[model samples]
Target: MEKNDLISDLLVKDDELAVDYYAFAHPAGFLDKTSVQEVATALRTFIDTKVVGNQPRRNVILVSHSLGGLVCRRAILDYLELGRSAGARIIGLLAMGAPHLGTDIARIASKFLPSHSVPDMQPWDELLQNLNRAWLQRVVNDGDPDLGLEQRGSVKCQVVFGLKDRVVPTASATAGAYLGELKAINKGHIELPKAESLHDVTYDVVKQFIRQCIEGTRTAPVRRAANVLADRARHLVLQDADSALEWTRYEEDVVTLGPLPAPEWLRCEVNSTRTGGLPSADFTICLALDGHFPDGVRIDYRFHFGRGLLTEPEYAAFGERLKNSELAPQDLDRVFGLKHLYLGVGEAPELRIHYEPHDRKYGAGFALLTYRIQPERLLGVGRTNTLHVCLWSIISRNHGWYSYRATRLVLEKLTLQLIAPFPALELGSSIWWCEPERNEDKIDNDRYSSRLEIEGPIPPGILVQWILDTESAGLSR
Candidate 1:
């Protein structure tokens, strides 16, 4: 908004990779009186003069901060609609602290300033909704020619936000509802595009995103993995082949009570196969804990189901099962139809079955059982739970891979948190997604060590692999 030379200050010279930067200047009054379309028109004029046909057919990366990001998006959409070649050249959009989704802060400002753009930034504003809907449709279609963008070319969209931003909250800045791979930095809204040095985390992430955009490798690995899983799940449920099932259980505990002592152990293994025209993967998890609680503890088994995974019919059946009084039997075996589990047309999408020992004798506090789930169901595609695991330890491992599929669905969001006894770790951990080149480095900490959040429409079923090393803390096996 001020006379800051953001582009010149941020885009330092790179010896290995040559890049040309351009900054668009507009009248200050435009911010208060002009509409988004008008601002976009001004931006389009600048691009036409400076970028279009000015260089060798190179792709262009639009890096915008704050309100400028919104203007850029509008201009891009306008170009796509007009069938302009400039639209095809847009490789990626790295929006920093831009309220792709309207921010409530604008609601307060609108009462004072009679600015047209300010109203457009209000939560659920009509203009914001229209833009978001169009953008989402384009993304869902993967930039299909039918959507106005070239079929062969794709635009990578990434949003970076400030965790402590007061003007724009994380949700608005990231635009989580419409965009995926939302990244958060430790800077404020004003400092987002003004990193002091290359060592700044925000600067590093922005640099990587720009490089990925230029190289045409903007899709995140997490999204690729999600797509694979979704496709497998669809095939398993839609085809006539019999479903394959695999079970795994890993646990570790410490019970230093009175007399009885239990051994501690850790085991991990993986087995894969193709059965009845469908692929099957299996994992083995083994953990042992030796400890006791004076007040007796309740091992809460919580299962989380991704949104939109259940069809209306399946949801109705699950509701009925919960209402059935006879189904309240405490016997886990009978409850799950003798196998301690069941999957069919009508069943709970997510199950939370608690296990409490009758007496504290301290001999394998929890049973060493193999919990099997069909690959399709475990990696849920449609209306089913795709992932299943026991929540017991401070450290856990999620290891598996899925084959690529054309019709793979998107994984909307993933959030993970660690319980006590485990100190909070910065977003940096041994988490790897999709390929070795891609790592989980864009992590944000809101003063909590046990919390990790990821925003995605990431492809399902790539490799969601990670290992938690607890050996240093004396947690073995």
Candidate 2:
């Protein structure tokens, strides 16, 4: 394509974020002089040949300001149809001042323009009306359509509104959850660049969001590792005569920990002593969080697992989707720390956990793991609809702390299927457990205390057992 003065002028600062930027070559009345299809075709060709080819797929986040956003939307549709593999990799679409519903400026500009002007540029007229079709809106806002605005699309969107923008009203920029809403200080309609904070902040949020997507898709699987560790953990606890506890739930506050270096895995432990040796831990599933979680924020406990529990087939499906999804790194990395593990909810909150092994040399085993599930703190939709225990092994025994304090689980069930034995006595701490006091007067010191606790969502027909075993007799023996 030949170089045009109009395109050169439009692309004033492509390097705003030290990356490829573009300017269009269409002249002042170019759209007016040409047919909509011709204008769209020319614009698409220019973007593909010049703009998009430079960046890797999904790595490019198109931040279109005003009319530029409209241009990006059109270009994306053409690119997808042209076999660009932009289905998932086209990370995010940020519309600074796009008039998805048309603007009054189009009306004002039309009065001065000759009636023969191009259709789309006529401002809120038939041409513009046809562009904002339901199909186009859906395309621009792709992903898990049911997840509101934020969860569904390969191309994420964030609408930036300038409170002081005289050209476009704030209402026009308001979109649902899929695309986040950002505000700028007194920035003009066409002069968003003039507000350095707005530009910098927006660019950072978008860049980070994309980076996380990339990291999540690229990170390796941790299911195998989690399984290995979980098995070891269970056996370790069962061997301690004093340590016979059930895994109520183990939820981790990953937000503060940032997206973990690898995907996270989860397993369930059931008590079998009650149901004549029935199978426990049947609903166990693991996840490789890899890079999808953002730093500092980790995963939100409320809706974190609703869509998170993916089977192997579901896991494999993400690969194809990644081709069209946006990729980015972790953002907001300061809230790093350990939280707690809870079981059930409300009046009978039980913090289910084995005694944490702090000083193992003196003796460490399940006898050391003591804790009940706390119901009040459980943040989930319903008890049965969502499982609570999510054990994260980010904490290493080499760290000297034995276990990470913040890495725990929360089970929201009513009863757990136990395949192992459980402690016979009950502890006094409503939701807390304590070590048994050493007394020389006792005959059989092997006896310990535990209560039968259950959470939500047990699959039908599957017999779950609750086991209370002496740590010393089990793994230790």
What RMSD does each model have against the real structure? 21.0, 18.6
Where is the poorest 10-residue window by lDDT in model 1?
251-260
Worst 10 residues of 2 by lDDT: 359-368
TM-score of each: 0.43, 0.36
What is the C-alpha lDDT profile of model 2 across 293-320, one tens digit per residue?
A: 1112211111112113344474344433
State the local distance difference test value for candidate 2. 0.35
Query: Each model's number of backbone clashes?
Result: 41, 116
Distance from true location, Cα of 355 in model 2, Å? 49
- Per-candidate Cα lDDT values, in order, are 0.45, 0.35
Top model number, TM-score: 1
Q: Which candidate number maximizes lDDT?
A: 1
**Candidate 2 has what TM-score?**
0.36
